[model samples]
Target: MLIGEVSQRCGVSTRMLRHYDALGLVKPTGRTSNGYREYSADDIRRLFHVECLRTLGLSLNEAKRALDEPDFAPSELVGELIGHTRARIAAEAELLRKLERVDAAAPAQWADVMGIVTLLRALESESGARRQQAVLSQNEGASLPVEALAAAALSEHDPNVAGALRWSLARAAGEGLTDLAIGLDSAVVEVRRRATVAIAAVPTAEATVLLRRALDDGDVMVRSRAALALGSRHVADAIPVLLGMVVEGRSDVEAAEVLGVLAEVAAAADVIVLAMQDKLDNTDDAPTRLRITQALAEIPGVAARGVLAELADDGDRTIAATASAIAHTLDRRKRQGFRN
Candidate 1:
């Protein structure tokens, strides 16, 4: 068959076929006398396998390596593919979380408040001290000293200044500033970075509110960070947000991280089971679904039984076998509990 026929049959593009050929990732079996690429039945089969691996989240390089190796075991290759899928899912999850954060801080009032807090903190710290010292040194030998000193001190304590500071702190806390602070120094960077740190410093109750707000933010990066912070705290309130990211968020990595954190929290078996069920139904993206299934199995209850059963019946032999292994482990635990 020619490239066009193979592409039509396999649903892969001719460009992709050509690129694959160039990369030695996929090649035709032979060539015609006129120099057109010729593919055999085995080539079609190889293409199908390559497509399956790609859908499973294997990089072209990884798929080629696995396929090219004569001794490659399907089980081993599946395992490697599973790991890669999990990583990609995690990255997507993170992107969703950042988007939520940006949405929450979209209001001008909110941004102004956060900006004020950053400005005040910058002033009260070493940066402020250096500025003050520089001003005093510059004023040395000037005649109008007493009035200027009083004016400067009063300005520092002005009601407007105080109000701005409070507002900024409130905004920062709302933006998950505490966690943001972990990565910063007194030397200020962008306004967003300052707001991130300041938001992280807010009281837990207030911070939770801010994080929740940001989870719905229009900006992906903001929502992503907010989800990430919420996940870190293992807050039950974040479960829905995390689930939305897993199901719909743009950034697979962030979503995966959120899911991983949620799994660690694993408070409700029903939630994990539902997530597993959803993943199974929505995507044949094997690697990500596998991670979700494994996470579901980790939850401590009988709710996961149905999901595990479904997974045990999966067409992918490796997934089915892994699911069976997990089911057996869970069954042992259940038996032990009954005996006790």
Candidate 2:
């Protein structure tokens, strides 16, 4: 077979076959008359081998060594190729994601495209200020990338940046909520807590469901934050976790305030008062008992007032004084017709 025949049959161009010959990777087996290059069966086989190695991301030099070196060990080279292929795949995937995010922004001009790219980079920047600016610059009607915002919100460590990212994620109209949900199940405890915090303000039913579910989260902080948000939403289902916060003294002040709001509902009042009483009965921790006493101040009606009156004579002097003070305040508020 001649060079043209080998090129045609082996799917390699004639120009490339000549370069292969020049590199001594796959030389022609013989020369035909009038200076036409000729290839024997072994030369065609070597060309096939070169093409095969190239498919595995081998350079031409590496391909020659693979074919010609008698003691060439394929294991190390193959492992390196695998690593390179994986790196290329990851780079391509990231590029695809960047392109998708940019497309979603729907930039109106080259300047807008550049601006969006800049903001995207800032979101991943090492500086928290830049990340925060990226989030804060999002316009009301602009098509900012919600997925990036959600991801940034979950992973953000800086309090200021996390707040801005959460704000932006909510402004995305819940589009990124699904991605944020992944953070709720993250192996990192802080990530799970952040996910709940970000979702807490979304005001969507899906966020509500997630917040409610997080009421049962293994992390106490997750449950407390989720309960606090759920409480603000007037969700009576959070009463139990809110009570648990009172028992645990974790964010008990805020938890008690939310419980007070929920206590406006008659059913919530009963559940909240009963759980507080139950915890008080089982625990001898003074601080927890005091927290429970203060939490009672938020609850209204006869049942809570009765609990306060009984606590006024409690064994602990601080508890007794705190309970007595709350009762007097309630009486004064009642006299002034003040109610939550």
Candidate 3:
């Protein structure tokens, strides 16, 4: 086949075939009387091999070596190609994500598009300060897309940056709740915890519902954060987890405080006091019992008074002293109220 015929049949352009010949990569096996290049069947086979290697991301030189070198080992080269291909694919995928985020912002002009792009890049910057600044200064630019904020909040490891991201997401009025809700089911424990952290700041009823669902997460941190958030929102669903936190000494003080707030309700007070009493009954460690005794001080109802009175003369002197002190204070308050 002549050069043109070879180019047409092999899909390699004539210019490229000439370049290959100049590089000594593939030379036509013969020449016609007019001295035009002519390719034999063997030459066409070599050209096909070069094209095949190119598809695998081999440079021309590497492809030539692969075809001509009897000792050329493809194993290492193939592995390198695979790694390069994966890196290229990852880069392309990231670009696509960036484009999607920009498109989602629905920029009205080039300036708005530029601002959003700049903000997006800053959020992904290596510096935690930059990431935080981007979120905190979001109002200076076109409003950030809520989905971007949600993604940043979920993936951020820096406490300050993550907090800022969550705050920003909250200000978006729960627009990113869908993304955050999906994060709740992530296989990654940190992701779920971060989602809960972000959702906790959102005051919308939808956010409250998501937090309630997060309370049942298998990860203790997720459940703890969700429970605490729920407790602050006056959701009774947090009671069981709050009680567990008190029992396990995990953020027990904050848990106790929230429980106290929950205890303001008459019915909730009874249940809270009864649960603490049950814990006291089953627990033998003096420190655990002491912690529970102190927690009971936060509750003001009559049921809590009964538990405090019984604990006042317990075997542990420290527990007895603390309980007696609390009971005495409650009595003084009760009497003071009566006097008025």
Candidate 3 matches the true fold with a TM-score of 0.81
Ranking by TM-score: 2, 3, 1
Model 1: lDDT equals: 0.60
Report the C-alpha lDDT of model 2 over 1-340, residue by residue, as the tens digit.
9888787788899999999989999999799788889999988888888899999899999999988899999999999999988999999999899899889767788877787788788887898887888779866777677777787788888999999988887887788889899988899999999999999969899999989888888999998899999998889989888898788878889999999899888888888888888888898999999999999999987889989999999999999999999999988988888555
Return the TM-score for each candidate structure: 0.37, 0.88, 0.81
Question: Where is model 3 poorest over a 10-residue stretch in terms of lDDT?
Answer: 138-147
Model 3 clashes, total count: 0
Return the top candidate by TM-score: 2
Residues 191-261, candidate 3, lDDT per residue (tens digit)? 99999999999999999999989988899999999999898888888999999998889999999999999
Model 3 lDDT, residue 118, Cα: 88
Query: How should the candidates be ordered by lDDT, best one leading?
Result: 3, 2, 1
Clashes of each: 52, 0, 0
Q: Provide the RMSD of all predictions against the true structure, rounded to 1 decimal.
A: 30.9, 2.9, 3.6
- Candidates in order have lDDT scores of 0.60, 0.88, 0.90
Give the winner by lDDT: 1 or 2: 2
